[model samples]
Target: MTFPRTLADLSTAELGSGYQAGDFSPGEVLDAVAERIAACEPTINALWHEDLAAARSRAEESGARWRSGQPRGALDGVPVTIKENIARKGVAMPSGHAAGDPQPADHDAPITERLEEAGAIIVGSTVMPDWGMLSSGVSSRHGITRSPLDPALTTGGSSSGAGAAAAAGYGPIHIGSDIGGSIRLPGTWLGLATLKPSFGRIPLDAPYLGRCAGPLARTVDDLRAAMTVIGRPDARDYSQLPPYSGDYRVPDFSVSGLRVAVHTEAGCGMPTDPEVAAAVDAAAQRFADAGAQVTRIAPFMSEELLVDVDRFWRVRSWVDYHGLDIEDQRRILPYVARWCTAGADVPGAELLRCYQSIQTMRQATVAATEPFDLVLSPVAPVAAFPAEWPMPFNDPDQPMGHISFTVPYNMSEQPAASVNAGYTADGRTVGLQLAGRRFDDAGVLAAAEWFERSAEIAAPERTVG
Candidate 1:
């Protein structure tokens, strides 16, 4: 029943095969994951509300199935973590905000139910900024979720703790939500693999929820496996569409013949770090070397869309708690209240105008890239920012600056992923983003894999085994 060694030692595919072949039991793997979480939680505070007993019980059930020689599902025996904002049955569902009306969830969110059905045990939930507003994982109520690589550095927030937990080897797979680079930014900062599938590829039963939850894993294979589990049509979510559920058999997708658009300025005016630019340029050349036609494209976004997208995101956060009482609001954190008020304060006319603007931008951006199979760019302007300063809030005028490189896809609802392209001289990570047209989740992953294999940007030993 013992596992090989570390949770870091296993991938989602390896864990599944091990269960199928009787190499180990889910109970053992879950136990190892729990132990790792125990060791790392003191520094990372990754787990918001964990029931070790429930995780163990689920693992035991999976172990029983293995004993009978009937594996439960593709993700059988895998240990995974869910973002706290996503409901887990009977768990407290708080936005981590002071002014928010906190409540316990009555049922599992569709994604959670799907993961459990696929035989993946949810070991715990990771921390997020109240309602996922700021880029820093810091919440006056939830404390800070620091990077495992260096405690002083920030783990990209909203999805901060999940990334830190995964990077620290607490689990092979982690589920995170992305609205404005929540999944991609943290993965980039921590040197992990993550996918923000196109809007509706994964279920979002509640349109009010601005972000869609997706997988964050150490390997592309693990991310693919997790995607198979949760990326499906869910009756609960009107936004979810059928998954591109094909075996990731590398299609006759020769890069040499493929057309890839490179966005050097990333459609936003923020400065792209030389390290990140060089890594992405190098990845593009690798694509060229592999036979893909790479062409640099001008910034494809409109200024109006950029402003409106930011407003829409802020409004979503406010709408979540706008109904609460002043007492409830007072209970939430200051920054959460600040953001919600900001969203509430937007002139009614401007709010309507912003919504309409987002639609126009989505169309224009899609039209501009429709000719290319994939678009490649940097994931963030900088590597890992200091944990002390949360992004978008660190500076007054630069509210959306840190996320400039990754937010367009969220606004457009396109499938995008952040692959570890390379690192800087100081050892900070650099991420190359590959974005594809809506519902081309597999294609985006395929492109990322090509870059990873070609660029040889393996996970660092310090972060993983």
Candidate 2:
């Protein structure tokens, strides 16, 4: 049966209901999604690899199940994109780097395994920066991933393609990873909803500090749905926490009586764009209208903490990249090479010092947030910048300034998300960040849903050719 063009726009829940109601077969939905991807890919560059044939086969199987009076699970037949950094068995996980011999993964990442188990069809692997390092989507291997809302603007990174795919309607659900706001940055710039769940909430095979996998979606409900499936424990990941029993559903509770703190600037002394700040203030007011106790607070980060965190990030990358031979290093992206060199010479004692400072920052953040139910801030100091730039800041000396607000929460290992607050006067998107204490992912998602319902954040008109 032929499906409407809008079939790709359905939320995960809506899509499932439509399948059960026989509105259209899963094959029909897959064909519509393939059309959407073909239409947007040339300009957006959101996907790096696609197996439409495999995806179609999966959809056919799901359609047979639905016709037989049974559906596989919540996400059965859903077209979902996994970020390139995540392994999908038999798919090459180049991660946008040219330095290494690109080998097809022999096993799926735990999250990928779970999503498929829930019957989600893997449509393709999305684009990212080399080593998943940059905040902008410019990659040596995959080219730049532009915003679907405006091709001249960046989609943000290293989950760049996931953001573009989510915004471009490739699907309702996209899997993204965040160490220093990779998911949230792209979500903000692309005008999508994303969650960087508390550390260990989603099991990951990453060896880096502060890295975790989560969902980027068009709606809070979709995020919740994806979380419920991917948040399950995986024995393959040694870092997996004891299984979480907390519900992933957004609570239907009122926003009133919740204590919230609004921070307009980073404690590291980064200045926010006035327009971005205004949007965040307006979001805070929405909470106030809902009877939430909202107070304007200074940023939770300090200059010392920011510096040490930056060092830790650089050294971590240095460790990963340093193992490559000189010839391999030469093939790496220039910006990535610069970051690696910056930390390669650091003494072991200094690295130890950075970890100590990180622990101190974590303690201080937990203490500061203990009294508040939620913390609200701008996801970035500025809206989406030029696609060619590595970051919004022009100075190489201050490369991480734009990520100041979001990265602190990563250090604290807390649950944080980027929600579409509004747009800049120039038509660029701005995101308001919501954070909750560690393991309070539900509260963060619940607050985002309240804002989404109250504000009615609209999806952008297709700007891609």
Candidate 3:
């Protein structure tokens, strides 16, 4: 089928304008996105399900509402995708794990409910690695969700499918959850803009420390659009911040005079790939170029901090794996299985100590970056690895080594993002991590938004020639 790329590739802002101006109908845009998925999915394997029949119905309703001049919300008629772990009524959330319960969720998760209320037509749920653990797309349940930039490369993970879908133009917006670097890691690998807002900024179905659901979009404006809808307090999450009354879409913002810290080393991860390091340094230079007082900052994360958090998560995932029947446990991706299984051997006292180490990391990260208003770092030390590899190095014994730059911010409860800053040798995108103090999500976003508008080159080459 020959669908025009215009409708599928338009950003949320463009869609809104087109819808109001009668340039196109929601149904037409939906068709374009469906065409995009049809063309991209076979090679990418990004989608877990497609609900076009339902989306078509919603698009029809949205079109009629648009014609009458009364739309449901700001995002009325926009196309979006939510990750598989986010429960939607009548759909089973396999969460990329073969052994996961296949029961249909009785109702939509809060993010889904919010998206529906915002009038965005959800095209479908995307894939992820088993149990949302790995930072790569090699899933035991769903197989590999490869990058749009290069089919041979991974999209990064556990937000794997959402990243791939967003990069592939399946839709303008895709919802993803990030505990460590799930959102930003994939965002960087896929050359998209993604945010892991301050903890509790976007209420989660299971709101634990450092875990929040966020969005992946082509532009920060679209990211703000998604935030305006889903970034609210939910009764389901006791940890949610007080309802955010501030406007997410700012008319203007600046980093002028703000203190900026450039962190080149995460202090514990694989040595930053030379290309990635150069890109990050160039990104930080942009802040200096814009009148922000940028300075080099010492690495705050240590081997102890990284190892401690790794131990805590191992025990945490171990508990989940142990609860599943032995046969189900055997179905998990072997890398993830071997990684978490060792958690069973940790002594009770060490387990508590491991948990406390998270608090220690939180304290250290918060203190270290407190002197600066913003911190710029690398999302992952390297660019995208092979699609078939479970981790960057393909080793379960040291799966977390690449996350040192990202995991600290999770524990610190700070808002952070991954914005495409540069390219690898083969033209793959490299992510430059941007972060701000707890609850300063808007500032972090503004910095990212600024980069998007100011970049001299296109961040990713996803356009069809």
Candidate 4:
């Protein structure tokens, strides 16, 4: 059984190296990926629309190009899944809602175009919760995605499918869109290395304050490679930053002399579980042992900021939900429907107050961490919950309680990543959030890679069922 390792289980760098050295072709890798998906997808429900036949043809073409020494770009043959929300041409972007368009998209999203142009094979689109709102994988259109670590446990969303697929060995790389803690929350829960790059680092056709697409994989190297492809400039997004001239590779670097701040208390939302806090403390110690100056930081987030942000998002979801016909409106997930209903009667002045609170949060986050070169915190305040729960608290009145640690960075436009830090008492994985100053994606990634090497970053056992 151990005669040969499955190519699907290889890291992105390993797959690319194998391709360059002729150890294996993209077609062979696609077959291996298909095998893995078949074994896991039925139980995990990690994917929605898949055309394996089309993917294999693309892989064959990529393999031929690789053999001819003319691979299209750096990620030439790697198999990858895009979050269901990231539009793919000719594929329906239900985006975890029944109200979403049934017709195929007319054009690819900017990141999708970039990845395809880099010759990456698109495996399929992963599942997500309604409107990519919830932190758990309780999708309406797509069924719940169980964590690969334990089928009974949740895979945090809105990047639910990408996280599950990455942990379950569907491929070496997967792309996800995160606003708030979507990518990092699930990454931690599923024990994957995920990066939610600084806003605009990965261009989005439809950009928002905290929304951006990023990579979730088993290794930082894969994330680095994904950044190389996804970070390319795309004019379609007017909000995207000017082309980044810096390298995307995680530099061979040291954490020595870095000023790193650690925070366990959020001062607002869900309190960090003892086991989760211990894991974060342990990650902080890793920095201390590596000669980095690790210091505890006070919580800049507050109950007002958390509630305001949640309300602001609720209004948004309410608009989208209300626009749907009555039948389609009823089709929304009950949890999401109940949550967004609060926004319907919201006063305009109160909505403006909510927006201002986001500004307060942004300013507070920057001011609090300005002295440090990097920041570390728990990705989520708790460990994995049941797979079927809509969120950690599962309360319509207060659904965003778990995102306090990760949301500030998104509001502040800082580059943040989640590395599988350690485990809870019962052995569920924990993620440590590494955040750097706004636009310092490279620095954040380099430090994450450094920690990735030092930590025991274990992959889940293959028994997903």
Q: Model 2 — which ten-residue stretch has the worst lDDT?
A: 1-10
Which runs in model 1 stand beyond 4 Å of their true positions? 1-5, 99-101, 243-245, 248-250, 319-322, 461-465
Tens digits of per-residue lDDT for model 3 on 192-237?
A: 8999999988887777878989999988888988999999888998
- Model 3's TM-score against the true structure: 0.97
lDDT of each: 0.77, 0.86, 0.88, 0.89
- Estimated TM-score for each candidate: 0.93, 0.96, 0.97, 0.97
Residue 252, model 1, lDDT: 73
Q: Residues 1-465, candidate 2, lDDT per residue (tens digit)? A: 122347888889888899999998789888888989988898899898998999999999999888888887889989999998898989898878887778898888889889888889899999898878789888878878888888889999889999999988888999999988999999889888999998887887763567888899989999998988899887777767779776676556779899999989786745899999999999999899889999887666788887787777788778878888998888888877786678888899999998999888888788878889999999988888898887677444554777778887777889998889999888888998999988888888988988988999665555873
lDDT of 1 by residue, 274-346 (tens): 8878888988888888888899988776555666777777776677767777777677666566655668778
Go through the candidates in order and give the C-alpha RMSD of each one to the true structure.
3.0, 2.4, 1.8, 1.6
Question: In model 3, where is the ten-residue run with the lowest total lDDT?
Answer: 456-465
Can you write out model 4's per-residue Cα lDDT over 76-103, one digit (the tens) per residue? 8899999988989999888798774688
Candidates ranked, most accurate by lDDT first:
4, 3, 2, 1
Single out the weakest 10-residue window by summed lDDT for candidate 4.
456-465
